[model samples]
Target chain A: MKRVLKLAALGACCLALCACANRPPAHALDRTCEMGGRHGATGVLEYQCVDGDGVIRERPQPIHRVISGGRNG
Target chain B: MIHRCPWPGEDPLYIAYHDTEWGVPERDSEALFAKLILDGFQAGLSWITILRKRENFLEAFDGFKPETLARYSEADIERLLGNAGIIRSRAKIEAAIGNAKAWLAMREGGQDFSDFLWDFVDGEPVQNRFASMKDVPAETQASQAMSKALKKEGFKFCGPVIVYAFMQATGMVNDHLVTCFRHDEVKALSRSS
Candidate 1:
């Protein structure tokens, strides 16, 4: 009886671990910092994206960076 | 010191908006339409951002004339997307134009936009005397009704929260806090009207 009970407990733990592993990743809130919206002086309509968490932070560096991909379109 | 709504703070432009235009009763058909569309554009964004860009928006959208915006096409969408002044969200831009068309249709139907909105409160402003901004709501019964009615008419981007902001801006409802000096002032204007 003790052996059977131990096996049942082990089975429950295995199922819990599998459920955690199969759980999907949390959906991250969108965060985008972009250009081409009245902030620049030149009328060229340039666009770029940067990391943001709901606060507007200016990216003053030159647009051509080594890792240029961002969430903003 | 004159007690004012702290939300506007010390920013001169915001102060001006709060003092001069925020809660004052606005009855003009096109003007009310303009404010509502502007409020619609304000979704998922701060009001100050829109306020700062108001001039550029006016210039780009031809002062937000409903007849003109009502006729916007894909070309106009591209033009707006190219402009670097407004919110620049394609969904928001399209909704604005769609709302303009809805507004024009409402006008053509011989129903005044102001009357349609103000009638929610039986042609009077429902005054609320909240003590602080924290007490103010993001949506209310009136706003839900407005949102439902607008959705029925195919107006877009007018959720209950957005409609509540519109009501506060257009004086269909007074949401100014009781401690704020503008609260009594706006309520007085509603009474006078």
Candidate 2:
């Protein structure tokens, strides 16, 4: 019974590590995410997470904006 | 190969950033604050690490608005540390919040952040024509002056080196190499009002 519990705990730890390795900063995963493409509608630049979990995960790139005076936030 | 400063390597994102944005003069107050905070977080880490996490920083910091960030509580700092996207340094995060408060105070003190910063360079981008990346300085007298002024204003995380990089990134000074296409292009941009 103790052996069973230890193995279960080890398995849980592995799962946690794996999830962490695959989490966020989506470019690290290098998966094919649709949102990572260029679409400069909002001032924030969004980087899409290409994980198996298809969702609205994006990294915002808010560097450029063509305001009246010049480039803006 | 197309000539560039070569510091950005061949990453598509880097190339795009170099071609489109770097060294472009920016007069926006919030944008300046965001870049300064990002540079502070870059201490002891490669800039690529920060670049990759830029989006995360923006989202977590309420787009880094001074008023919003100045109000961040301890609970917010804890939550930020747990976030997987941004650089998880407690000191850097705290410095960011502190800087935000400083920024707000400056604004309240009848200071136009844009005008105050631009005055460092006398309201014109300093045109540097270096022949190599090695020639580009890590920090200049102007950066040190800026750093001292910012520190006096009660801002945090702004040292000479970080402020120098911020200057380059914001086009307060154009550090692009003379051989690079962007050198002339970005220089021309500085003259456009």
Candidate 3:
């Protein structure tokens, strides 16, 4: 009886860990920055990736970066 | 003296707009549409110019109700052009009408305008902590995405820079300088919303 109870507790812990691993991170649902629109000559557009804990990490470049021409609005 | 963003300068009206309205998250769909159209007219000109003419623009554009402006005819265009109180550019006026139609189209498709726009930021105002105007950006990756999406949806004059300015004004992002008094106040507003 004691052994069965210990095994049951261990199974529950393993299931919890598996559930956590299966859940997607917040950043996965977050948008990746795109750059096909206008940007200033002096300013740089920073693309950041925020982790599940809301920690922002600097991303070097977006997946797409196109420079378009237009007057600054 | 209360430390504030230096861009407002010494102009009383600009100061008032900056203090009371700027960076306050606006959830109203109609109000957002009005500000976007106004910002479009603000292209190639100072925002203060548009700010001063805002009331006049509101009066002229029928409070920027998308339903009303979407149905404006050529005569209405002529009437708007003749009005000296607002920006007199035919292109801008025509774009405003087209934009109103686009706005309606979005609504007709069952998309909530505010939710569509807010989704870019994941339904919360981005809290940016810049210490000075020089540190602030003219455009961001999010604004770039927004500009592209708006253009695809038939919006005109909504380039990334314009979109960014509109975002700042509508509180999609809090770009207030850390030294400015309203920075924390605006951030609090974001949390409460």
lDDT of each: 0.72, 0.74, 0.78
DockQ of each model vs. true complex: 0.03, 0.02, 0.03
Q: Per-residue lDDT of A12-39 in model 1, one digit per residue for the tens?
A: 9999989866333343224454443221
Off by over 4 Å in 2: A1-73
Between 1 and 2, whose TM-score is larger? 1
TM-score of each: 0.72, 0.71, 0.73
- Candidate 3 has an lDDT of 0.78
Clashes of each: 1, 4, 0
Question: Which is the leading candidate under lDDT?
Answer: 3
Candidate 1 lDDT, B149-183, residue by residue in tens? 99888899787777777888887877777887888
lDDT of 2 by residue, B66-163 (tens): 99999999999999888878877777889999999989898999997888888999988999888866577767899899999999998877877778
Candidate 3 TM-score versus the reference: 0.73
Clashing pairs in 1: A38-B84
Query: What is model 1's C-alpha RMSD?
Result: 13.7
Give the CAPRI class of candidate 3: incorrect
Model 3 CA deviation exceeding 4 Å by range = A1-73
- In order, the interface RMSDs are 12.1, 15.2, 10.1
